[model samples]
Target: MKHILRTSMLVILIIILAACANDEATSNEEGNKDEGADEELKIFTTVYPLQYFTKQIAGDQASVESILPPGSDPHTYEPTTKEMVEIAEADAFIYNGAGLEPYAKQISDSIKSEDIKILEAAKGIDLEAHVHNHEEEGNEEGAHEGHNHGDQDPHVWLDPISSVQLAEHIKETLVELNPEQEEAFTKNFEELKGELEILDQEFHSQLEDLPQNKFIVSHAAYGYWEQAYGIEQIAVSGLSPTNEPSQKELENIIEKAEKHNLNHVFFEQNVTPKVAEVVRKEIGAETLRLHNVAVLTEEDIKNEETYLSLMKHNLEQLTKALSNSKSGDSSESEEQSDSDHGHSHGGDEEAQKIYDGYFEDSQVKDRPLSDWEGDWQSVYPYHEDGTLDEVYTHNAEDSEDMTAEEYKEYYEKGYKTDVDRIVIDGATVTFYKDGEEKFGEYTSDGYEILAYEVGNRGVRYIFKLKEEKEGLPQYIQFSDHSIDPTDADHYHLYWGDDREALLDEVTHWPTYYPSDRSGDEIVHAMMQH
Candidate 1:
C-alpha cells in the first residue's frame, strides 16, 4: 500500500510539470492579450528602410514591419495578404506620406483595423514634384496639364533636412509606444541627425566645385536634394521612377546633354534602368548610381552598407561624372549639336528616324480575342525577336501584331536584366512565375494579351489587372496596375481592334512625349552660364 501511494504521488507530480510547461507556452501567445499585459509598440511603415530604422531603435522589444515588399516599387506597391494582416494588427504604421507612396490611400481604404496608428513620415515638409518652373508658362502655353498629383515631390528622404523630420516623427511614435526607450531613441535620432547634417555638408561642398548648375536625375524624387543643394535635377518622371519619359522630352534631353556638355547621366538600382539606358545611349554619356534611400536590395543590404555609405558613394559618383564633363572629351557631340541643333542634328535626326521606323513597324491589335489566334515580331525594343512579345507565341491579331517577347524585353531592359518567365498563345502570352502560375495580362486599346500566363512575371509594368472592369477595352491598360510610359513615347499604341492612348488621360502629355528635362532652360544654363 505504501509503495503504490508513492508511485501515484510521482505520477501526479509528472502530470503537474507537463501541464505547467504547456501553460507557459500558451501564455507566451495569449500573454499580450491579458488585461494587464504591457502594450507592445507597433511600428508600421510602407518601405523597408523605415523598418530598418525602427529595428535599430526597438531592438527585440518592438514590433515593426514596413508593408512594402523587398525589390518592389514603393511608388505603387499595394498591400499583400501578409501585409494586410500586419496593418490590421499593428499599433502604429508609419509611411513616407505626402502623396509619395501612391498606395497609401488604397491601404487606408481596405484595412478596417480600429485604433491602428497611421503616421506619415513626410509630415511636416511642403513639397513640389521634380519639375522646372513650368509655373512660368501658363496652361494655355502647353504646360503639362494632367492629373491630380500637382507639385508634390515625395522624396523626403533624399534631403537630410527632410530625413530629420522623418526620423523625428519615427522617434515620437516610438515614445508613445515604449516611453522607457524615449531617451535612447531621442539620442539615437540626434546622432543619426548629425550624420545626415554632415552628408548634407559633404554634398554641398563636394558639388560646390562644379562649373555646371543643372544635371539630370533618374527620377523626380531627387527634387529635395536639388532644392537643398542649389543645383537643378531634371528627372524622367515626377514622384515615381516607373513613369517613362516622352520621346520629345528624350530628344530634348539628348539635345541638352550635348548642349550643356553634361558628363554623367544617372540611374537607380531599385528602379528600372531603361530610362537611364535611353539617356545614356541618346547622349552616349556614362551612367552612375544615385541611392534613393527607399529600400536597399538584398545585395546592398548584405554588403553592410548603410544609407550614409550609399549617399557617400552617390556623392563620389556625382563628383567623378561631373568632373569628367568639364574635361572636353566629347567635342564631337557638342559640335554636332551646334550644327544640327534646333533643326535636328545628326543624332537627333537618327533618333527621330528610329522612333518613326519603330512606331511604323510596330504592331496594333484591332479586335478582341473572344476566341484566340498569330505571331508578331519587333527589333528595337527587344531586338530580332529580342523582346518576349516578338519571340513569344501569339494566338490573335490586333491593331498591331503584338510582341510579347518585345514587351518583356522592354521592361527587362529597364530593370537592367531579362524577363524571368514566359508563356504565350496565338492570341495571348502568359508569364508563369518561377514559383507559381498566376501571371497578369495587358490587352488595351486594340492590342490584347489575356489569361494566357497567370503568375508573377517579374515584369514591373503589367503586373496587375485591377480585377478587370466591364466593357472598357476588355483590356484597357489602366485597368492593369502597370506604370509604363505610353503617350510620352512619341507614338501611338497598337491594340487589336483599335489603338489606344498611353497615360495621356492622367498625364495629359502628347502622343510619345519626352519624359526627361532634356530641353529645359537649366541645361542651357549649365552650358552657357
Candidate 2:
C-alpha cells in the first residue's frame, strides 16, 4: 500500500513538470511572432521626394525616413552625427545622384559593411547640361572650356516622366532588398505610374496651346521642362541660387522681360525674393512665385504638398503668366517693361524648332490588338534571370545584322554569343535567346511590355502603329532607356502590311546606340527618321 502511494505521487509530479515546460515554450513562440510582425526594412533618403517616393512604393512593408529635415535645402543641408549613425544602421541609403548631395558619396564610402546597399535614386537618368556662371569669370563661352563647372541639373524629379523612372528604380531596389514584398511594391509602383501619366496629360493640355513659350524663372532648374516642352526657362540666377546674377545679367533679364512682355517676375517660395524683387521693380512687373521643391516649407508639410501638387502649382503659375502676357494692355506691358525693353526674340520657325523632339506624343496608346495581326521581329537580348549583365558576353557576333564594332569588340573579348531575337506574333511577344524560346507567348499590356527582361543595361522598346496614314508610314519605335551610352544600339523598324518587308527593312532601320547619342539626340533621330 505504501509503495503504491509513492509511485502515484511521483507520476503526479512528472505531469506538472511537463505542463510547465509546454507553457514556457508557448510564451516564447508568441513573443517571436510579435517580433516578426514588427520587423520592417529601414531605408534612409537624402531628400523629401526620395522619402515620399519610397514610402509610396514600400507602403507598410518598409520604414522610409528622410535625413534632410523639413524646410531644409538639400543642396546646402549637412547631416548630423545622429543622421550618420542612422545611415550606418539602415539596410539601404538612397540619394539623388548627379552631385546634388555633396556628403552622400563620402558617407557611402565610410560605411564598412558590404551588407548595406547604397543606391543612387537618380541613376540611369540622362541629366541635362546646365551652364554655370562663375563669379570670377568674365567671358561666358571661353571661361569654361570642356567644363560645365559642376552644372549638371540634378532636379530631375521635377519632370513627371523622369520621376516615373526614379520611382521604378526605387521599386527595383526595394524589391531586391526584400523580394518577399515585390508584389506589394510592384502594385504600388504601377498605381504611382498611373498618377504620373495623368499629371503628364494635365501639363500637356494646359501648356500645349499657350501663346508665349518662354518664362523668366528664379533659377535654372527647368531644363528638363525645356527639353520636354518647348517652354524656355530664362533664369535670373544660375543652376544653384548661390550663383547670384551680376548687375549686367539682371539688366539683360529685365530687357528680355520687356521684349517678351512678361508681366510677372517669378521668384521661388523657398528662396528669398530680394533679387527677384529688384528685377521686378526695375522691370515694373508684378511678382509671381514658383516652387523649386528642392526643399519644402512648414506650410507645405501641413498642407501635405507632394511632388505632383507642387508641379501642378508651377503649371498654374506658368499658364497664367504666359497666357495673360499675350493679351495684356500697353500699360500692363509697361508695368512689366524695363527702360530699354525692345529686345525680343519673337516666335519664328527657328524658335519653334525647340519643341520638335518631345516624345510624349509617341507614348500614346496603340491601335486595339483586334484591329490587326502580324509577326514583328527585332534583335533584343534576354536571359533566364532577365538580367542585362550578360550583355557583355551575349552581345558578341550573334547575327549578320549585328553592328561591326559591337561584333568585333565582344568577339575579341573572347565571348562567343548568339543574338536574341524578339518576335511579336499578334499580341503575343516571344523572346528567343541563342535559338531557344526563353520566353514565349508573352502577352503585352497594350503597347507597353507588361513583363520584360532587365539587369544592368537600361532600355525598353515600344511597338507603335502609325495607323496607315498618308506620308506617315507605319513603324514600330524602339525606345531605348539605357542610361549608359555604350551598352547596345536600339533601332526603329519601318514596314507595311507585307511580313517579308520586315527583313529587307531591317537594313534601313536606324541604329541608335547609347554611347553615340544623347536622349534628345536619339529622340531627334527617331523623329527625323
Candidate 3:
C-alpha cells in the first residue's frame, strides 16, 4: 500500500511538471510575457499565402496575419484605417512587391513606422512593370492590374526557384530580428530550401519540353512564368485591370488572334473580363481559365490552393491553348534583338471601358441583325449559404440543339447588345441587372457586386445595383468579357439604355454581341430584392 501511494504521488508530480512545461513553452512561443523568458518576434504578411509561408518558417515563434480580408480584391484595394493601425504595430511586414500590389507602396508610404522590418517577398527576380505573361495579358484584353509598366510583373513567387529565395529572405529576417534563433532559423531555412528545390525540379521536369509554349490567361498575371519557362502568355490586353482599348485597338487584337491561330482567349473567376468576348468570337477561340495568385475567393482559400496549385492549373490551361497555338517559325529567332519593351501598362481603364463602352451602348460593330433587346441584369445565383440554384445561361443553353450551324436560325444577327443600368430616379444609389424594374428594394447604390457564371452559354455577369439613385454617377459597364463556351447559346442578348449605337457595336459581330430587344426585367427584379 505504501508503494502504491508513492507511485500515485509520482504520477501526479509528473503531470504537474508536464503542465508547467507546456505552459512555459506556450509563453515562450507567444512572447515572454512572464517575468523571465525570451519574447517571440511578431510577423505580419500582406496576404494569407505569405502568412502560410511565414508560419512554416517561423513555426510557433512568430504571430502572423494576412492584411487583406477574405474575398477582398487585393489589387486596386486600399487598406482600411484599422488595417493601417495593425500594420503600424507589426514587427515585420511582408509583401509581394514585384509590381503585384501597386497599393503596397502607397500603404507603406502612408505608414510612418520605419522601425518595422519590411520584407518584399520576391527573391532572385526583380521586375519593373509587366513581364512577358503574353498569353494571360491577351486573354482578358485587360484584367487584374495597375501597378507597374511592362517591366515588373511581380509574380515571381509563382516560380518555385524564386519562392525559395523568398524563404531565404524570411529566414534572414527572422534571424536578424531574433538572433537567439539563429541556429534554428538556419536549420529551418535549409530544410525549406530543400523542399523548394524539389518543387522547382518538379516544375522544370513537368514543363521542360511540353509541346506548347502559349496559352490564354484571365489577366496580365503570369509574366514571371514565361520568363522562367518557355511559355508565352497571350492575354487579352496589356497590364492594368483599368485599361481598355479603342475600336481600332480591339480590331488589331482580333486580327492577331486570327493570325496567331489562337485557340483560347480566357478570363478570370471573380471579376469579369468584359473585353475578352469580342476577341473570343472574332478568332473563334476556346474559353480557358487561369487563376492569378493575388487574392483567392473563400472556396479557393479553403481548398488550400497554394502557388503550386495555381501554377499547375495554369499549366493545364496552357495545354489546351497550345493545342492550337501558332508555331514559332525560324524567323522568330532572327528578330530576337534586345528589343526594349516600353510597353506601358496603361490598360485598366481601357479594359474596363471595353465592358463599359460596349455594354453601355446598344450597337454591335460586327453583327447588326441579332439585336438582344432583353434587359441584362445581375441575379444572385448563390444565396446566403452559397448554394446556386438559378439555372445559368451556360447550363440553360446546354441542349445539343444550339450548334453553330443551327444558331443562325433564331439568332438575331448583329446588334451591339448593351446592358443598361440606371440608378433609381432619386435616392442614394441603386443598380439593377437584365433590365429589372427599379423601385422599392434596388434603391441603393451601396450594393454593387460583380458576379459571373461560366459554361456553354459564354461567361456572363449578373449585376446587382438596387440602392443606386439619380444623384449617383452611372456604375461601370462590365459585361463585355463574356466566356465563349463552344456548346453554349448563340442567341447573345444585349439590354442597354441606347439602341442605335448599341446595334452599331454588334453589327461588327466578334467585337460585340447581337441583341434584338430591351426591357425592364433586370431593373424591376433588382429593386424587389
Candidate 4:
C-alpha cells in the first residue's frame, strides 16, 4: 500500500509540473505575438497605387492592405461596414485624396481611434481642376455620380512625378508612425524616386519626336500627361468612367476622331468597352487598352504587372498611337509638304462673321461645308505672357532640288534644314531666310486649309481646334514643332475665351511643360499677345 501511494504521488507531481510548463510556454508565445504585432505597422490604402507606394516604401517593415478589391472601380467603390472596421483598426490608412475615393473621408471619420494615422498619399502633389456637380437629390448615399468637387482632379498618380510625390507622402507617414524604420523608408523612397526619374526620362526621350501629339482616351484621367507632355487627350467619358456620355457626346467624340484622324480609341481594363467599341466601329478605328493603375485587373495581378511595367506599356501604346497617326486628312497635304512645305473662343465679330459666312451659310454648300471655315491668324498656342511654347522652321530650299518623289524621300530619310525664323501672326506664315510666305484660308474640310502666295497656286495644310466648339478662331495649324513630339508646343493658336487662350501660360497651365518659369512671366507674355 505504501509503495502504491508513493508511485501515485510521483505521477501526480510529474503531471502538474508538465501542465505548468505548458502554460508558461503558451504565455510566452502570446507575449511574442503581441510584440510582433506592435512591431508591424498595419497599413490600409483605398487604391492600388497608394497600396503599391506603401509596399514599395515600407518593404518588409509593415503589413499593407488595400481596402479596394482588385479590379474594383475607384470612382464607384464604397466601403462596407467590415471595411470601415478594418480601417478603424489599422495603424494607418492611406488614400489618394483629391476626391478620388469618396469613401475615404467618411471611413476615416468613422475610425474611433485617434491613434490611427490617416494619410493622404497625394498630399503634396498638385491636383488638376475638375468639377463634378452632383445633381441627383435622392442618390446622395455619398456617391460621386453627379457631384462636382471644384478644381480637384484626383488622378495625380497617373503622372510619374506625381507618383514620386505620392510615394514621398507615404514614406513620410510611415517614418512618422515608426521612427525606428526611418532609414529604411528613406532609402526605399530614394530608390523609388530614382526609378521614377528614369521613367520620366524615358517618356521624354520616346515621346519627344513623334509625328502626331493628339490622342483619344476612354476617360479624362490623363490630364496630368496632357499638361506634362503637351499632348491633347479627348476623353470619351468624363473623369469617372461611370459618367456615361450622352448620344450627342458620342457623336461629338466620333466627329473629333474624324477631325483629328485618330486611328485608335483607348479603353480601360476596369470599364466595359461596349461604348468605346461603338465609337470605334462608327469611326473605323481600332481599340486599345490603357491601364489607369487605380485598380488592377485579374490578368494584371496574375501577370504580376507592376506599376512600372504598366506605365512602360502605356508609353509604348501612346508612342504607337502618335507615330501611326494620320494627320487628320493631311496625309495628302503632308505628301505635298515633302513635295512642298506648307502650313476659339466665341468672341470677336470678325471671327464670328467669318465663321457664319464660311461655316454656317447653307446656300454656300461647298464654302461652309466644314466647321473650321474661317480666317485664323496664328496666336501662340499658349498665352503670350510666356516664351513661345515651341518653335521650329522648315526650309523649302533644301527640297527645291529634289523631285516631288525625292522630296518625299528626303523627309522619309529624316533630313531637315532649319529655318532662320518662322513667324505666323493670324493669316500669314513667314519663313525669313527661306523666303516663303503662306496666306492661309479655310476649306470645306476642317483638316486641310488653303495656304497661298501672292499669285501662286495654294497648298493645303492640316489644322486642329483646341476642342470641338463653334467659333471663329476654332482652327489652328500644327507648327513645324509638331514633327518633334518632344516640343512643348504641338498645335498652334487658341481661339475662344481669352482665358482659354492662356492655356500654356503659367497663369493657366501651371504644370504645362513642367517648367520653372513663374506664372507672372506667362501672364506678362499673355498681356503682350
Candidate 5:
C-alpha cells in the first residue's frame, strides 16, 4: 500500500511540471512575436516602383508591400475593404500622387489614425499636361470616359530623373517615420540616386544619335521620356491605355507613322493590345513590348525583373526599332548614289526637318552670344585625371561593336583641349590658356548650317571678334546641339583665324561645362553624350 501511494504522487507531480514547461514556452514565443512587430515597420505602397524603392531604401528596417496585386492596373484598381483596413493599420502609406491612384486620396483622407504616415512621391514635381487624342475634336464624352485626371499627367516615375525625385520623397518620409534608421536610409538613398543617374546617362547616350526619333505607342506613358531624352512618342491612345482613338485620330496616327517611317508599334504588358493590333494590322508594322514599370506581370516577377532590368530591356527594344532598316533592299549603285546625295545635301527635306527638331524646335530664333555667357571649364582635365573612365566603360558596355579600349581612345581625342577655361560675360569673351588670359569683344555673326557625312546637320552660331586682341582667334563658333537661341548648358567650341577652316575641323571638338561642377558632376554630364 505504501509503494502504490508513492508512485501515484510521483506521476501527479510529473504532470504538473510538464504543463508548466509548455506554458512557459508559449509565453516566450508570444513575447518574441510582439518584440519583432515593434522592431520592424510595416509600410504599404500603391505601385510597384514605390514598393521597390521603399524596400531598397528601408532595407531590413521595414517590411514594404504594395496594395496592388501583380499585373493589376493602378489606373483602374480599387482596393477592397480588407486591403483598406490593412493599409490603415500599416505604419506608413506611400503613393504616387498627382492623381495616379484615384482612390489614394480617398483612402488617405478616411484614415483617422495618427500612427500612419502618408507620403506622395511626386509631391513637388511639376507634372506634364495630359493631352488626349479626342480633346482636340471636342469629344467630351470620350475624353471624360477615358481619362479622369483633369490636365495633370500622373506617370512621373517613367523618367529616371523624375524617379530620383520620387525615391527622395520616399526616403524623406521613411526617415521621418523612423529617425533611428536615418543613416542606413541616407546611404541607401545615395546609392539609389547614383544608379538612377547612371540609368539616365545610358538613355541619353544610346538614344541621342539614333536615326529615327519618333515611335508609336499604344499608350502615352512615355511622354516623360520625350521631355527628358528628346525622343517623340506618337501615342495612339491618350494618357490612359483605355482611351481609344476616334476613326479620324486613327487615320492621323497612321499618316504620321507613314510620314516618320515607323515600323514598330509598342504595346504595354498589362493592357490588352486589341486597338494596337488594329493599328498594327492597318499599317503592317511589327509589334514591340514596352513595360511601363507601373506593375509587374507574373512572368516578370518570376524572372525577378527590377526597374533597372526592365528599363534596359526597353532600351534594347527601342534601339532595335529606331535603327531598323528601311522596308526593302537597294542595288549597289542605288545605295552609292543615295549615300553621295546624303553627304552632299544633308539627305532629303524630311530628314533635315527631323534633324532640326531632334533636340529642340526648329522654329527657335537665332540666339545671341549672350546665350553662351557663363564661366566654363574644359572637360579635358577631367578625362586626363581619369574621372571620365567610368563613362567610357559604360559607353563600351552599351556598344554592340566597340571595345572598351577603342571607346576610351575615341573619347581621348574628342576631349583634347589646350584652352583650360573660358569666361563669357555679355559681349566680352576671355580665353584662359596656360595661366594667361586673352580677352576679346565678340559680336554675333549669322548662324551657318553644316551637313555631316552621317546625313545629319548642325548649326554653328558664329561670333566674330569685333577688335583684334593678342592671342585671340578671329572667329569663334559654338555648337551645343541647338538650332535656335537658348542658354547653352554646355558647348563644343572651335576657334581660328580662318572661319571656313574651323567649320571643316570636326574631329577634335573640345567640350566644356560650367566651372562650378565637380569632377563627378562633369563626368555625369559627359555621360549624357
Candidate 6:
C-alpha cells in the first residue's frame, strides 16, 4: 500500500509539471503575436501630398509623417538632425523630387541602408518647364531669382490626374513594404482613384465653359492647371513665392490684370507677399486665398483639409473670379484698348501655346508617314563605344542628384536596340540588322495616347504594314513627345507583329537620331536634352 501511494504522488507531480510547461508555451505564443501586431511600418514623407496619399493607402498597416512642418516653405526648409535620424530609421522615405525639396536628394543619398526605400513621387513624370517672365525685356537680370527650381516645375500634385499618379506610386511603395495587406491597399487605392477621377471631371465640367479663363495669382505655381485646364494664370511672382517680380515686371503684371478686368488677386495660404498686396491694391481687386498644398497651415489641419478639399475650394474661388463681371466701370475707349491688345498678356506666347493645347482630344492631329521620313541611326552603338559617356556625364551634372554611373545605367536600359539602322522614305521603312535588311510598305494607322505607370503620358504615331513580309515587322510606332502632327527630329521607335502589344511596350524604346549628324553633334543634342 505504501509503494502504491508513492507512485500515485509521482504521477501527480509529472502532470503538474506538464501543465506548467504548456501554459508557458501558450503565453510566449501570445506575446509574440502582440509584438508582431505592434510592429507597424513607419513611413516619412517630405511634403503634404505624399503624407496624405501614404496615410490613405496604408490604413492601419503603417504610420505616416512629414518632415516638413506646417506652413513652412519647402523651398528654404531643411530637416533637423532628429528628423534626419528618424527618416533614416524609417521603413521608407518619399519626396516630391523635381527640385521641390532641395535637401531631399542629399538625405536620400546619405541613407545607405537596404532596409529602407527612397521614392520620388514625381519620378518618371514629365514635368512642365517653368516659364519665367523676369527674363523679358526691361527686367533686371537678377530679378526674381531668389528661389531657383531649375527649369522643371515641381508642383504636380495640383492636377487631379497627376495626383492619381502620385497616389499610385505611394500605394505601390506601401504594397512593397507590407505585402500582407495588399488587398486593403489595393481597395483603398481604387477608391481614392475614383474620387480623383470624379474631381477631374468636376474641374472639366465646371471650368470648361467659363466666360473668362484667366486669373491672377501670387506666383507661377499653377503651370499644371494652365496645361490641364484651358485656364491662364497671370502670376505676380516667379515659380517660388520668394521670387518676387521686379518693378518693371510688377508694372507689367498690374497692366495685364487691369487689361483682363480681373477682380480678384490670388495669394497663397502660406505666403502672402507684399508685392501681391501691392498688385491687389493697384488693380483694386479683392484678395482671394489659393493653397499651394505643399504645406498646410495649422488651421488647415484643424479643419481637416485634404488635397481634394483644397482643390475643390480652388475650383470654387476660380469660378467666382472667372465668372464675375468687370469689377469697375471703364470707358468705351479702354475696352477698345483691351480688345486691341488681343490677349497678349505681356507677350507670353508660350503660355498661349499651353492654353491652345489644353484639351487632349483637340490637341493631337493625324499625320502621314512622311513626318518620319529620314535616314536614322541607333544611339545604342554610340552608348556602347563610350561615345555617349560625356553626354551621360552632362546629364548627371544637370540632374542635380544622380551620379554618372547611375544615369548611364538608367539610359542603358532605355537605349538598348537590336537594330542598327532605319531608313524611312515615303511610305517604305527599311530596317537593317545583323548584316541584313527588312523592308515593309507601311500606312498611317492613327495615333494612340498611352498613360504610363509612372504617371506621365505619351503619344505613339503608329503605322501598319500593307502586306505581311517574312522578315519585316507588321507594325511600327514612333514617339517623339509631340502630340500634334510634326516632323520628327529624332524619335523612339517600337515595332512588333502585334499592334496592341506594341502600344503597351513602355520599356526598350530604342532611340534613333539623324544618320547625317556626326557623333559629336549627336552627343551635343543629347546633352541639350
Best by TM-score: 5
lDDT by residue for model 6 (1-529), tens: 4433443454445345545555676768766976765589999998898998888888888889988888998877867655766676678999999988867776676664576899999998888877665222343442332256778889999888998999999899988888888899999999999998999999888898887888889878899888888898888777777766678888888888777788778888877799889988887776666778898787577556788877877786677677764644221111100111011111135423322222355667776675676579998898889998996687667666779998678668878888999987445688999989887778888988766553445677889999888988889988764466444667788888999998877656788877877778787655542
lDDT: the better of candidates 1 and 5:
5
Runs of candidate 2 with Cα error greater than 4 angstroms are: 1-38, 131-149, 326-529
Tens-place lDDT digits, model 5, residues 427-465: 668889999888877888878777777655567789899
Clashing pairs in 2: 284-335, 388-455, 458-481, 458-482, 459-481, 485-514, 485-515
Model 2 lDDT per residue over 1-529, tens place: 4433443444444345535554676778766976765588899988777888889999998888888887776766667655666676678999998878766766676563555788898878887876443221342432121122275788888888898999999999999888888999999999999998898888888888787888877767788887787788878776666566777777787778788887676778667546677877776665566787777777576545787777777776777667756333222111110101111112334322211211233333343221212222232222122222233223333345555455334323221223234433223333344566522222222333221122111122334343343422233433222111111223333333433343233223322222323333433332221
Local distance difference test values of all predictions, in order: 0.49, 0.57, 0.48, 0.56, 0.74, 0.74
**Candidate 5 local lDDT, residue 451:** 70
Q: Sort all candidates by lDDT, best to worst.
A: 6, 5, 2, 4, 1, 3
Query: 27 in model 3: Cα distance from truth in Å?
Result: 20
Q: List the residue pairs that clash in candidate 5.
A: none
Best model per lDDT? 6
- Over 138-199, each residue of candidate 4 has an lDDT whose tens digit, in order, gives 22232344333436778888889988988988888998888988999999999999999899
What is the clash tally of candidate 5? 0
Q: Work out candidate 6's RMSD over C-alphas.
A: 27.4
What does candidate 3's lDDT look like per residue over 1-529, in tens digits?
4433443454445445545555666757545445433556677677556776677778778887778776666655666544555565567888877656655655555443455788777745455346433333343344433533445666666666777777788888888778888888888778767876776666566677655666555466666677676776666656655565556666766776666676667676465567777777666665555666666666565445665556555555554456445433221111110001000111246433332322332222221111121112222221112222121222225545454333332222322223233221111123343655333221111111222221111122222234444432232222233222111112223333443333333222221111221222322221221
| Global fold similarity of model 1 (TM-score) | 0.53
Where model 4 places Cα greater than 4 Å from the true spot, the runs are: 1-38, 131-149, 327-529
